[model samples]
Target: MLQNTLEVSVVKNLDFIESGVHICVVANQVVPNLAPILDRNLKAKRVVLVHTADFLQKAKDLASAYSNYQVKTEFFKIQSAFDIVSLRKDMQRLFNFYAEQKPLINITGGTKIISLTMFEKAKEYELPVYYVNTDDSLSWLVPDVESVYHLEDRVKIKPFLTANGFEVVVNELPSSNKLLRQVLDDLIANIDGYKEAISQLNYYAYTASSSLKSVSLSENVEGLRKLVGLFAETGLMKIENNKLIFKDEDARFFANGGWLEEYLFHQIKQLGSKIPKIQDNLCAVEVCKKTNSVKNEIDNMLLCNNNLYLIECKTKRFSKDQSPEGGVSSAIYKLDTLMRELGGTFARGMIVSIFELSKADYARAKQYNIKIVSLSELKDIKRHLTSWLS
Candidate 1:
């Protein structure tokens, strides 16, 4: 019988899985099943994935990723996962075919009925069955409980998303250079001085992009000369005839606020020094589902302990020149939509911008449970991140 008292804290090394045994799992949420299979100590074996109609493509994608790691995989399908009687018949047939192998069942990914039904079948067949706890520990059920085994495996963005039926089609990681750091830090420290200056730079840079030609700007413009010189020293753009000239689209992008994304990416990585699993910090990440025509590009994102944090960075989008006072609500709407579509349990959505949001938009963001970090918040980003990430 599965008991409520089946909790253990002592880390137990799980070496029970022997060579060449077929490991079975349901494909509802693939990460839980992968906890043990992807652990460093576990050797390659055939993973048999039992999935419903909803997860067919995801199962295929997961199978491919597993093959890359040299683990063999197979699939079983149940037309309706909630159809208990038909599912039991199907599961019985599946078990009989693998009867010789006596596969292990991972009761980690399905509805209560699905897990309960599988557990009943495992008990009947005297097969080993275990559940993955919230802390990534394994709890044995069938064949009786003994200990909870802590999983050494921690998953990154790609595998986690793939397991959840998504794939990263395009990923542009942040740059690891001091140039961006200087520009970002200076702007953060003197936001007041650089506020209008950045907006002016963005205007000309956007003009250059619109015309497909380099636009000239005089550094002699009052309140802009000092900030322009800082950017000039960074070689982000060139100067001619006492004016700044954007050389290409890349420089234009930087002036038009690409640096904000880069800055947030670095600050997120800095959290790694105090926390584990920070290598998945990414910028300009585009993801798509394997079975659909849907796709979204995240400005900056990171994965911490399986929870995805999606952030949208903006410069002139919310400014009065580009949008009306309540325009932030629309961007918040996009973030909220992405969060609901991509964010699983414990996931979060946030908007970090150079401009402060209007009170109405701020209330709307609060209503959607999206976090807001504006110009003032950027200065103390470390503190805010520690709270949010922790």
Candidate 2:
């Protein structure tokens, strides 16, 4: 009986012939999956990417990440992509030449027909066939009951981004920004009764017409006066004669840009610091992305375990009658774009808003793999952050 299960450590120790290689028939859209396979020890002398001419640049980009290993590309015609017969012939030809060296085949990507044809050939040649699971882990596809092997590491986010054509700026959290942290901790500590009040206060901060002018607390909120007092007590802003005043730049910064972002950033940093076995977890605030053609910014980017957690902060209220063009939807769109560009499908997105998301918006967020942490979840953000990374 053949041993169908192989541990990652065992697989890495396998000896490869001088000309042996790992062949992957990949498409432009599925190029992200290639990273995991390459990250794991495949016991191959080199990597041969089978892709179309349109994805040649992407293939080369993928190749650049593995400088220690030889990586190269071979083009196939797009018109013949779904033609299984053509793919089979190509596989047969490849097998005829590489059979002596015993190359491994990964049927993890490409069109359905392409994958099917590759599967057939892998079986016919009695070759090793593998697939990368959704979580960027590896497993065998041919065996009825296969052993699941998790690679010890994943490609880091910065390299992954650079390889995928994103020019990223590494922005570090300022060491001198402890005042905002103190204020944020105070706000969360004293937020029991003042949830709505804090939200309403944030509204005022966000909408204040001028930095010099004190913004009047709305009279309609049930405990509007107490909320203003709490803001003053927390040292977030000054209050006199029932108007909320920004005493200095820090007060104005938290009020307008959002205390919610500061709070979440604080929690995220704390979680990353205390967590165990995290390869690399770093926070970058206002990290800018510029390629040859476009420019965009991320509010907070958490890079951990070679995956990206993109967080966008919002302090505004979302409408019950949610439209695709509404604030909630726009945030999701922005996060999704950043994910695709920066981390491909491997990136996870999150929006932490002091406001609540409507049912429609929540469902839309779930569909796009964008997690939402709204007003209700603010109290237990640490748990949410832990579960999100887990």
Candidate 3:
């Protein structure tokens, strides 16, 4: 049986003589038992085993066991096996020799190198290759390729064929063929079902930070920071003294000058347009920086006719569990005082926390009719703002 396999391998290589093929027989140290399979079926005049230093002892043991085999099997140490440089050099040498001698079987050990270099060289030389895996669990060979067969289940044929562009088929193979497939499938299915039933089921949803890291902040804060960074990346803002400042890059800022006021009013306008217009023509004012006023530096202020809006912009960093209750309360007090000074001009107040907001803070803002806009939500706001302005 071994002789017949060897004859077939040799015949296949000869058929592609113009390609000057090199047969790669790959095995792992854990599966030293696969050595004989390569010895029996590969009828090449010369065979080479690409073994890593980690598997040298196992290769020697296998070599000693098969000392009586008629085929000459030589071992080549794969220096820095994982390194691309070493693997490429080894593959070049192997392919160059195969071009000259047309070796029947060039067995490579381990999947790491086999999947990378050896397989690459086989494709380059159009060589007939076979993988000898020690693990009897699942087939790693390319699916549907008759030339590639697993030693454990030779009868179970792959659904795909062996070709240069065969990765598409192999990638599509059912993950059930993997050992952990069942566990993963069950977990995902349960999660999906739970998510689907969540809306219908009256369940109390609470937000908590993962214990994996300290200084846990809400996803909102993290997302806003990322957006700020993206704006900086696009040269819209510059970081100075750990604060984001609008860059004087374009004259568009002259029309929408104050960053915070412009950003908030734009969002309110966008949201109001989507919802029913409870108010008329939008008006915005910057009151925090008013001279002689004891109010905290207000980011932006908006007034839609008689409906006045006060906005407090904060780029402060806070974790998921941390609430900006104190900061927000201070802003509300300042805005109230400012509104009183302006003869009750402002009707609505808004706290634009560019960072994550704790569940408590979010609920608190909702109670006061103050909208809480997260950084991720701001992206959608900006997209609409562009369309509205355009």
Judged by TM-score, which candidate is best? 1
Would you list the C-alpha lDDT of every candidate in the order shown?
Answer: 0.71, 0.63, 0.40
Stretches of candidate 1 off by over 4 Å are 1-12, 19-28, 42-44, 134-137, 142-148, 210-221, 291-295, 317-326, 358-360
* Models ranked on lDDT: 1, 2, 3
Best by lDDT: 1
Q: Residue 14: error of model 2 in Å?
A: 4.8
Please provide, for model 2 over 1-390, each residue's C-alpha lDDT reduced to its tens digit, 9 standing for 90 to 100: 323343333333334323346777655444334454455465544666777666677666666655424455444334367676677788777767665666677777777787887777666665666777666566766432235756555555555555665545644443336655675666666555556776666666655556634566556866545655555555657666666677665566566645665567667667766764244444444344433555666667766655777888766565554566666877788789878877766788988776666777788999889988876677788898888888
Q: What does candidate 2 score on TM? A: 0.68
lDDT by residue for model 1 (15-89), tens = 444445445556545557665677665554878888888777767867866765567788888767788888788
Better of 1 and 3 by TM-score: 1
Instruction: Locate the minimum summed-lDDT window of 10 residues in model 1.
Output: 2-11
Q: Across residues 1-390, which tens digit of lDDT does each residue of candidate 3 receive?
A: 012122222232224323222243334322323322333233333345566777655555444433333334567676666788878897787667654564433344466655567766654554555454333222223212434332322110110000000111111111112223332233223432322222211111111112111132333344334433434434444334433344442312311223334445444555556543223222232222222433333344333322334556543433344333445554555556544433132245556544456666667666665666544444454453333222
What are the models' TM-scores?
0.84, 0.68, 0.29
Error of 1 at 247 (Å): 3.6
Worst 10 residues of 3 by lDDT: 156-165
RMSD of each: 4.2, 6.2, 27.1
